[model samples]
Target chain A: MSSAPVHAPASNDVIATIRDKALWIRRRSFQMVYEAQLGHPGGDFSAADILATLFFGVLRYDPERPDDPGRDRFVMSKGHCTGAFYSVLAAAGFFSESELSTYMQPLSRLNGHPNRNYLAGVETNTGPLGHGLPVATGIAIAGQIDAAGFRTFVLTGDGELQEGSNWEAALTAGHRRLENLTLIIDRNRLQQGARTEETASLDPLDDKWRAFGWQVEVVDGHDHAQLLEVLSASPRGRGRPLCVIANTFKGKGVSFMHDNVAWHHGVPNKEQYEQAMAELV
Target chain B: MSAAVSVESGFFDCRDSFASTIEALAAADERIVTVVSDSVGSSKLNGFRSKFPERMVNVGIAEQTLVAVGAGLANGGKVPFVSAASCFITGRALEQVKADIVYTNVNVKLIGQSSGVAYGELGPTHHSIEDMAWLRLLNNLTLIVPADPWQTEHAIRAAAAIDGPVFVRVSRMPVPALEHAGAFEVGKAEVLFEGDDAAIIANGTMVHRALAAAKSLAGEGIRARVVNMATVNPLDEAAILSAARTGAIVTVEEHSVRGGLGGAVAEVVTAHDPVPMRIMGFPGFLPTGSAEWLMEHFGLTAAAIADAVRQTISRKR
Candidate 1:
């Protein structure tokens, strides 16, 4: 399931391998959520492609040297989607893939949220919404100060943006013109109980980020080619941060679950799990 | 007993010492950066700003960003010293302090300025009395309240030397320099006066008042011991248990009576020894006035503390 080297993006093999890796991530994420019974499958399925592409086809780091200062940082700010986040990390050889069975078990290295202290690839602990961006901005600013060539990437749930702390970090990041920072919004219209627009309108979302002095990029979140192309691109806006609006479906890849808000955190029964697995396979 | 103990001529503001120490630390180590919320003048961090302008990140009145930025800087291999008004920084961005700084175990120094009733005239909105209670619950965060400017300077240095998150609370009110015999340690309390009758455990500006209380208690043949418990999180259990063994104890703090230093000491004392104790602090909000007036209103004075010690001794088993 390993993708071709991400640093060589010009090759078509990289795109093909990434597509395969994205499927593996989606299938594995579904399995993890089914076992955990207490997880966010909607957001997990929605952000699967973005997470998969970033780990396999974009981020630069050695699994052996998890603490290497030179490595790029990716903070999963939308922490509820630990199912997909941990699945991709295992796919990338961060830990034994067999350990995925231990998800949500007591004392498991994989908690409900990503804990950087426990997991190697996790950059910071994120469970409460609106935390990851500010910390990512801090890491980016540090990279700038140290002249460290590594870039910082943070993925936030579109609904999580309702929390004010994200905007606070956004204002600071844009004002500082943090060129090494990239913010990705999982624009899966569905939230916990309702559509993001029905709950709290975030229409013209791209314009909102642009107003905060960031270069906005709208892309198909589930498209690996698009995610790799946009993420791997050199931060174009000089003295400005980059924000990618990744439009995706809540329960992507599975027929019954796709765009269904009920699956936000609803665990599948045996029949539903089998049907979902059949569709994913 | 109304004893007139003459006060000293020289006084120093802990904030000034904090700002100067930040500058010195930043000069010595490039990793040190000062993050503030445009309180350079109030926080006295303009010295650090003037010297290393790039290192001074003023997020401009945003407390949440101030804390997150500090956490980020620490993640980036920089030792960020976040300085802000204790109330705004701790109260406004408590979640950030809890999640970004403490829970993650990042190496960031949070300098909570003008803690306690230092902003008494501004009323309860600016009061940072609840900071200790709010922060002590979170794990991996070190809480240190320096008694004076010298202790503030040393605390900042000690916080920098550590590898995880720390909150160093400093008062805006000028305090007289104290004579501490032992070296400064993060969690260990310093015993200034030794007495067998009862112990007065305090921190920050209250430490000096506790010492004064012990002095006045001596007049009544109540030999009270005084302990400067600077570190609140890792409560000096050895000192507290020892004090509890004496059958009488009084805890003082410039904070709320409940869920603070007194609460911390009482937790250990009640479980270990169950001594007769009187905790001295603000029972609740006070009427707006000067810091001195507020202290008196809350019965937070040397004489009042001495009185509490006598009462505890009277009930001692």
Candidate 2:
């Protein structure tokens, strides 16, 4: 699954291809989590569309030249969702799809957390919450200083935003007027053990971003067309950074798991895996 | 431009050397940038910020962001010298340092300003005595504690030349630029004085004092070799092994007695060749006083180091 050339306001063919890729991501990522038995499958399913659209329909890079310097960066801040992240990167030709079977195996490249050193297309190491945004802001600031065309996008779990470092980075990105930076919050509303609001309320999240000096865009996270349209827009002259709060369900594709918090990191049993795979089609 | 800054006073602050060197490096290389947590004034980087206003990134007293930005800048083809007070940079954003830079193996230079007890009167909360202990245990991060202006400049340049994580500890305390043989090399100790009776291994504000200790010990017919072990993480095992040949050794630093220069040297000596040793530094937290008072009170002075050397030699055999 090599990267398809991105088209702004993507054509019907492109949207169909992205949907196909997103469905493939759901199937493959869940398969990985099921085999690993120690993975975060719920968040992976929730972020599949956003991750798929970004890689296949929005980002610009050559799979051959991972460090082309001008390539846009997609930082996976919600690191535990490696099931989706590594799947998308593989689809975009970062690594062999066969390697996905090695997930969580000893000495495997696919660790529980994404390691940039271990894998290409992984911009940085992230497992601890609140780290991706600040680092992405720095990368955006660097692009701004050099007048470089490369944009930086970071994806975070809605619950991960509860970490103070993200707010600290949010303040810097807004103050610097980093138009090249975009923060995509996967608002699944479900965290590890409970709902995000139940854990530590973040209801007025869009207004919070606006107050911090960012341009906010609320979108249906699972809608491939909405994600591509909003993410593919030119960042020129935006003045401030963009924050896209992507409203999504924790377990999006399978009916039994949709909006289910219990599936946050629940490994599918043999019977459940068969049912989820059948429903994913 | 190459000479040590403000050498007229015979005492120089390493931070001055740090500022001048970084500014020079940035002037030549467009990729060189500075990131600070509102530490331009304290880091003596006003000159850097003025010269390259667009390149200096002040993240507004946010250490975690300051460090993460440095890693990001490195990813964007820039060599970032992230400057901040050592305590905050190391203690506050330690996880950021570990994950973003060290774990990622990013080419970022972290300038830990006013390290050790340089914040003397501000008390232990401000003191960065635990930085070395915390940082040394982390592999893949280079830790350099330059002794004076000359070493500081060399350390900064050497840090920039490398392509991995580095933490350069700079002090605000004043000290003369001592005579170093040549350019600074990471993980190599510079032997300032030679003797076989015992070896004095020290770095940062304590190196010159160790040399002075050697000078005093000379009059008593006790020749103590002085080694300035700057890069703490790599540990210069060969130099330490050679120093251990003296049968006795004294490791001094401006850090806590545990998990620092002394602790590093002890680890090497015990593994390769066991030797009698004395570790000279603050015991833990110290009573409030000026930097000089704290040094004297905690046996970091020449007289005190010499006494430690004598005691270790007595236990040698």
Candidate 3:
């Protein structure tokens, strides 16, 4: 496996770069979604920063050698956020930035969700909620089996966690003491429906993860410095998995759509798209 | 070839053979592991658990988690055989089986114990007659349904040696050993008895029935070729095409007529050779009964299978 040129920047500097990239990703993602006339823009905006940080800074992956055995595996379990994912991958040099225009078009590799068969950086084809964590657990276990130091990280929605399979995987990850596995819940309160609290209160969500035997950490999902500090921190309680509860707004960086459930799968019209892009600028 | 050589019968459950073979394999290979969904005693994996406690993961009634965890374990460099009730293993954790195991092409062996109506009076919920159909739809999965105890043991050992996703349905119902001591090929079908008149292709608990059906057909002055098709996915197209050349074929299975071994055989025969075929199995929902009674009711017995072969052959003539 060929290693990417590693420039060891100060942690703060890396965070700042990630923040700038996240803004760019949000703007690009919104444009793509608007042009496509179909996509979950709300979740994409909510998760753009986290996706940017992981693809650019946190994950040790070479786009040229996507299937490298030693590469850290990342699964976008909340697959509805494909716009953000595609934007981040383009920025990471997995594919050309021009390819973003092809998203959701006829015969486009960029589908509604991440598909490993078509896309480069995607580890698994995830769309249905609660699937990514289990698949990530498998990759983590595979890493352990080969005694490879590569870690597996999965990004799931706070609402997507409602699926029982995620909890099932959580228990197994904890029981197996898969220290190499990390789960980052994009805890943007709004879901496809109303607010998560109104739909099904996942308040005390951190306790729920801790009770399941995970090393729990909460971070301001939009704050690049805080995100980097929490993400790079090693698993504190040995033999337990790590779960980072990332508090975020549903439609971060977009003023009208932020924390709004209607934007969950809403396609922004020309005016809204212009306004969202202007805000990002 | 003469009619299938019938010997004095003795009843033995294939699960016992599976347990013993798994135990032996685990003793030889440290990488071999078993993950059960709270079915240690039911799956007859008590000995495997006792010998390899660390390797035996009892996930305590969570079927989906059992499969997911097994996939996890397999990912971690362990050859994991996920042991659970076939009904739950295939039905409950189907998506996990698709996503984590088969679609990902992980080297996980899913052992569906007590497949078919093996859980007999426990009701339809416990019956795993749909396992074959459900698993067959997935890609990169090798589906096997062993005929008897000897075949079951061989399948277990062979699966461990192969490095890919496999689902082997082990019958809890007692069956006399079918295959004699021989090498177990993963995808090759065993031509237990051969005749050009007509063909009877069967798998799992139904293989013995097909053999017996051949004998009864012989008594009726008919020579029926009997093929024990253990591997369902990478089907023996050569054998099936040869059987198709026999003018007529009869497929028998312990599952539904839809998408089981019978369906697979018919698919091959119809597409290439277009032979006169009769698919015999549980056609629809079965009423509650003992396993043996259900088999008889569904015309899965030797006499009924022979009758179906005779009928199909007569149609061809």
Top-down DockQ ranking = 2, 1, 3
- For model 1 chain B, where is the 10-residue window of minimal lDDT? B1-10
> What tier of docking accuracy does candidate 1 attain?
medium
Give the winner by lDDT: 1 or 2.
2
lDDT of 1 by residue, A1-281 (tens): 24344456546767776777778887887788888888898888899889878887788888888878888889999998988999889888889999988999999998999888888888888899999999898999899877788889999999999999889999999998998999999999988889999999898999999999999999999888888888888764467899999999999988988999999998888899899888886
The prediction achieving the highest DockQ against the true structure is: 2
**TM-score of the second chain, cand. 3:** 0.95
* Candidate 2 pairs with clashing backbones: none
Q: Write the per-residue lDDT of candidate 1 for residues B230-298, one digit (tens) a residue.
A: 998767789899888778989999999989999999999878769888989997777799999999978
lDDT of 3 by residue, A124-183 (tens): 767878888876776676565556777788999998988998888888788778888999
* lDDT tens digits, residue span B192-227, model 3: 887899999998888888998898888878999998
DockQ of each: 0.79, 0.90, 0.41
Judged by lDDT, which candidate is best? 2
Error of 1 at A267 (Å): 0.9
Give candidate 1's whole-model lDDT: 0.87
lDDT for B304 in candidate 1 is 94
Top candidate by TM-score: 2
DockQ score for model 2: 0.90
Off by over 4 Å in 1: A1-9, B1-8
Q: Estimate candidate 3's RMSD in Å.
A: 3.9
Considering the true interface contacts (CA pairs under 8 Å between chains A and B), give the fraction that model 3 also has: 0.46
Q: Write the per-residue lDDT of candidate 2 for residues B49-138, one digit (tens) a residue.
A: 889999999999899999999999999999999999999999999999999999999999999999999899999989999999999988
